[model samples]
Target chain A: MNLALVTSRDTDQAVRVASPLAVRGMTVSYGQTPAIFSVDMTVRAGAMTAVVGPNGAGKSTLLKAALGVIAPLAGSVTVFGQPMAAMRDRIAYVPQRTSVDWDFPVRVIDVVMMGMYRKLGLLGRVRGQHKALAQDCLDRVGMADFAHRQIGQLSGGQQQRVFLARALAQEADIYVLDEPFAGVDAATEKAIIAVLQGLRDAGKTVLAVHHDLATVPDYFDDVVLLNTQVVAAGPVAEAFTEANLQAAYGGRLTTARVDPESVAG
Target chain B: MGAEFVALSLPPILIGVLVAVACALPGNFLLLRGQALIGDAISHVVLPGIVVAFLLTGLVATGPMLLGAAGAAVIAVVAIEAVRRLGKIEAGAAMGVIFTAMFAGGVLLLEQSDTSSVHLDVEHALYGNLESLIWLDATGWGSLLDPVALAGLPVELPRMALALLVIAVFVGLFWRPLALSTFDEGFARGLGIRTAPLGLALVIMSAIAAVAAFDAVGSIIVIAMFICPPAAARMMTNRLGHQVAWSVVFAVLAAVSGYVLAGYGPLWIGAQASVSAAGMIATVSGIILGLAAVAGPHRTRNG
Candidate 1:
């Protein structure tokens, strides 16, 4: 019976290897207030997952801690079945649009080139090819024409797209974004979704902290309904139900409704 | 333009320029990071560092002073972080609480200690002795080729030059990472750049510039140069590279023109004695910043 239990555990580990990002027993706090509690989550490989929660629900905190931007009080994160440190280059992250100061004196191209820093290493010269690659990423995000323009000159949606372009320039296997669609125009929203869908088609893993619940079913294949902890995490059809939404948001979110059958089909 | 220029005016102007460049270079990043007051804080704290160093060594030497100032800068940073974290105070408030206390303590120490034999005093610390750093060994332009004459140059000149070189090299070697981290710390950290250490390194570089420049040009120029030239340069360009380049140009301009105007401006006005070159340098930098704010093309956010 013990041998059977060990074999089942080995099988579970094998299954975890196919997961792009996995977090176990993660907890984080700010000052005296706890932001997130012990939470366990695993995102499927080559799939789009949306992390949805109400305001102050630790959605952004979870992403930040998992990415090591802020130290976690407790937990471990793995990327591609390896420690996040070892697999850092294989993951790209797009911080929230408001996280950085737009008034910073840098052109659109310069911001995009930042994505290539991991590959460039310290003291590595940015070659012409690197510029072209950054430009290509900008083109992918429909921001190619704004290459010479300063970042502050662009609108909010354009800024978000530029950030996405920078993440694209990383060309990593996994893409993590925080609030990618928050304050963007409808056109930019459509364009960004199309690009993200293209990334999915190319078999890249994507996990984003999505606030808009109306588009969750259409935008993602998987959903992690979270408040302070993981309420439910699985395919959008199974995990993004009315019960899960109620459990995660309590009375804060009254309008978000997801049809399990529609999402499933 | 012969002996008078080489002996009296040249060394101060050069030192002034080096100080401006050193402070303004790091000032660019600090200003953009919205931590321009870090420079201001550092200059204010430098007095206490120098006084403490003097108290420790009982000698007014450059090496001991630099170490003491560097040590003080580090302590100030640590204290600020601690207050901000432990007391849950805002960063600006914490900085204000610590720097002002340290600076006041330094002034009190200077007053209480016996330093009548040395050239150390509040006036010298505030305005500096820029006018007195004259090259008496140089007779004329021919002194340029004379090694013995060069050896007689004020020690502050070579020291400031070396400080400027070190700052420039630091800015150059770490330009990419610094800019990236400054622009977006989270993204930079995500790329495994180690943002915290990079930030501390930047503060250390700023402290070095502050300490080195504080000795010759005084705290006034140290504070002004750290904010003005870079703030003006920021108004001139939308690109970081261009902004850095423009800051150097502005630093040089402020140094040379401020020195010249201090000496000759008073003479032209038919006055007997020249005004303080350090004060004039700081004033010139402020004026340049004002000009950029008013007329610079990229001054506004829209641009």
Candidate 2:
């Protein structure tokens, strides 16, 4: 680890408790309506954590607040015990594919290159080396051949892969994803899980807002069940029980069941 | 045609090309962001800005006009934001109301003032006084190099050219940030790109383009050039780089061809007098846009 790049305070905090993400008494509201309130969660460093919740469960909101995308009505979040701003270069964010205008006239390579925009902004030109790095990222996600295709021409799984490739291009210490597995095929889901597991092996943290519950224990080492608050958060086997799932999903047992009516994980 | 006739026609034609290119360059970003009417809104809104500046300074200098125009651009955006919030109106309606009200107020102010003595008037605000700009005091190209002749150049042409250069530099320098911000604002923000300053720069660039084109192309053509060339270019290509290139090509084509046709089309029909060049340029850009909208590769007819 490059101690020179990180603040001393952050290093001390990481040594005390190695956690990439920490949300203490966090609250977020939208126009007088509280979306997520009084939530506290700390994701273990170098682990894959799945944030599982029903729709509007503030699962995505939690990630947004952690990244400073949405202002928290209360509480604070830190990355490796430092403010997100100070450690921004170490965080890679992958927003939901639906949030992007897929119909925008751009090639897949252009979207991947956006991850490198921060490094090349206005001053450095996009050289062949940058393109090679972007291509390598794309190849990792198994979409290298589709680099020249227009964004609007991709399937749901392909679009998701492109976004992951973008985050890969960031070369960050941690990745935060929103709804990555939504509507993707089983093969894409496996591929994504493999890539995330590889990152975990490399001592990098990945926090994803996941909807599929059946594979939580199989795909993740940690779990945070949330519904306007942290219903439960710990090791996946410990926190992902049926009772905690019920608490997060309210009385709706049908959708709360593990992966409800899908192929077995 | 005689060399004398060619020299007489040179300045206006060049002016049209410069103004069209200047307006169209920034227009590509506006088109991509789905803010095509912002140019029109700026052109109309800046009328009051120019009028108030002229009213206060009692002179038609670029300095006061530019200051007033920039101020109005800021006010116009602020007013639009207020209307959208207060009236609970959508952005389109809010923009429409503010620009039209300010334009009407400008016309009223012009009518009430002693602008009759000045070259500026309400009628000229719509169609422009481009036909009257003649820079051929000397005979040929050699005399054009003379310092007196150089200094005596029409201010409108030079102003439009400088605006073009500024637009080129701005887009070139900020291409990455601007493209990222426009395409995905949230993603840009997450990348720690401060999008607000870039957005403000975009609005300021539009204001500058509007102010520069106002004296030469008028409010109507300023708007037409802004929306039409970019929209046509968008239809012609799916890549942003190609869109910008095709937009410049379309703009130059429209400018030169429109000027030539406006000044010479009637002579082909046995009529003696020419039509308004500004109107022709606007019309030609519209026709190009209409053609692209109907026939361009980007059209969506079927799967």
Candidate 1 lDDT, tens digit per residue, A55-75?
Answer: 888999999998999999999
**Candidate 2 on B6-107: residue-level lDDT in tens?**
457777888888888888888888877777788888888887888899999999987898788778878998898689778887767888999999989888
Q: TM-score for every candidate vs. truth?
A: 0.96, 0.91
Q: Cα lDDT of all candidates, in order?
A: 0.90, 0.84
> What's model 1's TM-score?
0.96
Clashing pairs in 2: none
Clashing pairs in 1: none
TM-score of chain A taken by itself, candidate 2: 0.90
Predicted candidate 1 versus true structure: per-residue lDDT over B61-167, tens digit per residue: 98998888888899998898789789997777888998999999999998899987899988887888898999999999999899999999999999998988998
